[model samples]
Target: MTSRAIADIRGAENLDDLYRVFNENHLTAGWHKKRSSLWPEPRTSFQPLNWRYAEAAEAMDRAGAWMSTEDAERRNLLMFNPVDDNDYDTVRTLVCAYQMIKPGEYARTHRHTANAMRLILDAEDGVFTVVNGIKLPMRAGDVLLTPNWHWHSHYNEGAANAYWIDVLDVPLVHRLEPMFCENLPGGHQEVTSVPDPEACPFVFGLERMRAELEQAPARADGTRRHRLDIDAHIPTVAVTYIDMPAGGRMAEPRTTASRILAVLSGAGAAQVGERRFEWTRGDVFCVPSWHAFEVQSASPALLLEVSDEPTLSKLGFFIRDPAQPK
Candidate 1:
């Protein structure tokens, strides 16, 4: 690991002598390594996993019985990967959480270096998220952005509890060692303006997305996809909305991009590598990088997919099966 150690290890004469020198100098020889540094394909440490919405919702209900905004920052269940070392990440580069807010509760105001977004799973009319003083509505099937360092908080004024799927590039930030966070002086931020949901750049309403997907032609695999055009500023993540009709199936080509997908409507099943998952509305699942996947709609379904594709493409590390969609 050190230049001096490398220098000392190179002065040995024979194989045993070289290994002894390596041990003495605390060095490892590339030629004698037990494992190669490069591989023919990605071997991700994380595995494909799913977090059912029903289980999370039930947990949230139980938490709501005692936990409040005063007790925890967010009443949520983290979709942690079921890996030996991973405790917080849903995939290698992202962390997904199922968050719930009860009526008349606040999630407090804070911001971090991690870019984040939430897919509204079961929100009512009075649920809203305030980002940098702009209030945006949180309705079912809507996607709202809270980019890095933009102070944001959630509040529910509706009579019912609000639930949403939160996806963030926190694990990526944590790995990069540039993570930073801060809280507002007051727990809740003052809403300086309330923009029209139609014109607000931070809000992608369900109606508009559905309209666009309806007008788009289906792919050869019978799935219509719209690359949500809201990533002009957020560089780490790309969002896509896929619409599949009943019996429609998409055999996704293996790609070097890990993704977290949430079912926004109807029911579906997904095959990630050798694992299969049957999902309904609000269920979230992950597909690790380089895993072959297939999605089938038992009923007309809509999915919200979030991936690190933009980051990989920008870094020139992106690769996919030749059959991948354009």
Candidate 2:
């Protein structure tokens, strides 16, 4: 339209005139079709994170004293990504947090549509999670899964507090709009089997997993690789272990799935795009989708990695950039 025509539309004297002009242009005020382009270009945000153990532990101690399991249900501090404006999420599709259960405390029995997992950071034999009817002991460095809609509860029988990283696919479920949760009639679920520390296959199995990976064939560059434990029921998420030997480095790889990695042992430096992150034991960091990243160590280093690869693959949205620069 000409400048005069635009001016006339903008200077419409009455609502009827504006409505007539809008109708002539085939437009309505209901919703703008071009809003998507005018809004944020990328729906997802990516921010690198490094949570220190000392600070996290101190915060957990304070939270444990401030809240009771019965009052709060579970004492957890969500790891909010810096790039997120207000969402209490670690990544776009995942919610990662640290949870603390003090001795003599019990997390109420509950189940939800979102799948969940726990990577034990600090715990003793007496601290366990009862899923369905099986009691799975929570030990340091162990990964446990509480699949979707499985009744679960936590109890701490030890003298000290139990800590672990709690991860859930809540954001994804929320987007799908089918999230549902229910509390058990009783406060805690019944334990059908006796609490045994060795019942779960992946509990305290890090050493065995490492040894088995060592025996497997190595890459042409000689770095040991393995995709470790995965929840059979929740196939969309998985845990992997990688060992970087002294003076060895793994090439940066880029993929569609986001990855959250924890340093299980040793020290290393990670290159994520143009940024470099130095990490040691107990340190946690993340690599968002499509960002090329590499891990190198001056000494043997073990890393525990978690990702939503299965879900991406199932939806046929998974892609890996083999040409990503090292």
Root-mean-square deviation of each candidate, in angstroms? 2.5, 5.5
lDDT of 1 at 177: 93
Candidate 2 accuracy as lDDT? 0.78
Q: What TM-score does candidate 2 reach?
A: 0.83
Model 2: worst 10 consecutive residues (lDDT sum): 34-43
Runs in model 2 lying further than 4 Å from the true structure:
1-44, 195-204, 229-231
Stretches of candidate 1 off by over 4 Å are: 1-26, 322-326
Per-candidate TM-score against the hidden true structure: 0.93, 0.83
Residues 266-304 of candidate 1 have per-residue lDDT tens digits of 898899999998999999989999998899999999999
Q: Write the per-residue lDDT of candidate 2 for residues 1-326, one digit (tens) a residue.
A: 55865786999998778766777677765553435545422234677666666578789798777679988998888877777475576766787888889999999999999998888888986998988978888878777788899999999999998888887888778888899999999787888976545456425466666777789788766678777555567786877877788877887577888888877788878887667878887777777777778778878888878788888999997777766544
Top of the candidates by lDDT: 1
